[model samples]
Target: MPIRFTQSCPTCGRRVQIRASLIGYTVACQHCNAEFVAEASIDDGSGTTDSPIGVEKIAVDPLMARVEEALQRAAKERTAVN
Candidate 1:
């Protein structure tokens, strides 16, 4: 499994997940579509990489999350088709 961590985009300042192995490589931000070198963020223990996304989990509705997952999957399929 690829180890992933969140890093804020330098352009839009939006948090984006970057593979730990991708550090020092060019990566594109999902939110801003800006390209920059990926870096591993130092965890302050406030949100450590040991946990999901380096943060304590926020309780999420299971059904809603499943629906959102389906929607995102469908969107990806649509994008691929185009």
Candidate 2:
């Protein structure tokens, strides 16, 4: 069975076709440089398909944690240096 989905560009409202099987996968919008997941299923009467999965803010959490750790380390290093 072939999977079909719609992906909307974050930068642009342009919609693009994507494969449902590619869910949880990261894909870049051809029109815009925005990247997002190809999840969300949708049925447009013609057939069942997937929609453009919005970019989740999950990766930011880990990145923020790492930044905090680096800042703490830098503070400690500065204190020691002085």
Candidate 3:
């Protein structure tokens, strides 16, 4: 059986299975369209490597989230009225 490792897509955090032979190979995340190296380090599940363009997770602001929720509520109310 071929050795397989699980890694998360840096851009989307989707799990991807990679073969041992593919370690240090370039791969594209189907879910996020982000390209990264397939570093198949099976220990601790990090499995991240150098990417052409660095991918960083963005932090959502609490104020922005509240504003979005308010907007959604208003839109739903308007639709119900219509």
Candidate scoring better on TM-score of 1 and 2: 1
Greater-lDDT candidate between 1 and 3? 1
User: Clashes in model 1: which pairs?
Assistant: none
- Each candidate: RMSD to true structure? 10.6, 12.0, 14.7
Give the TM-scores of the predictions, in the order they appear: 0.52, 0.44, 0.46
Clashes of each: 0, 3, 0
* Model 2, runs deviating above 4 Å: 43-82
* Residue-level lDDT for 81 in candidate 3: 100
What overall lDDT goes with each candidate model? 0.69, 0.63, 0.62
Q: For residues 1-82, what per-residue lDDT tens digits would candidate 3 score against the true structure?
A: 4445667888899988766556678988877878888764324336534332211111135665565578779999999999
1 or 3, which is superior by TM-score? 1
Report the C-alpha displacement of residue 44, candidate 3, in angstroms: 4.4
User: Worst lDDT window (10 residues) for model 3?
Assistant: 50-59
| lDDT (C-alpha) at residue 33 in model 3 | 77
Worst 10 residues of 2 by lDDT: 51-60
**TM-score, ranked from best to worst:** 1, 3, 2
- Residues 23-78 of candidate 2 have per-residue lDDT tens digits of 78898888876888766644466854545342232223566557657877999999
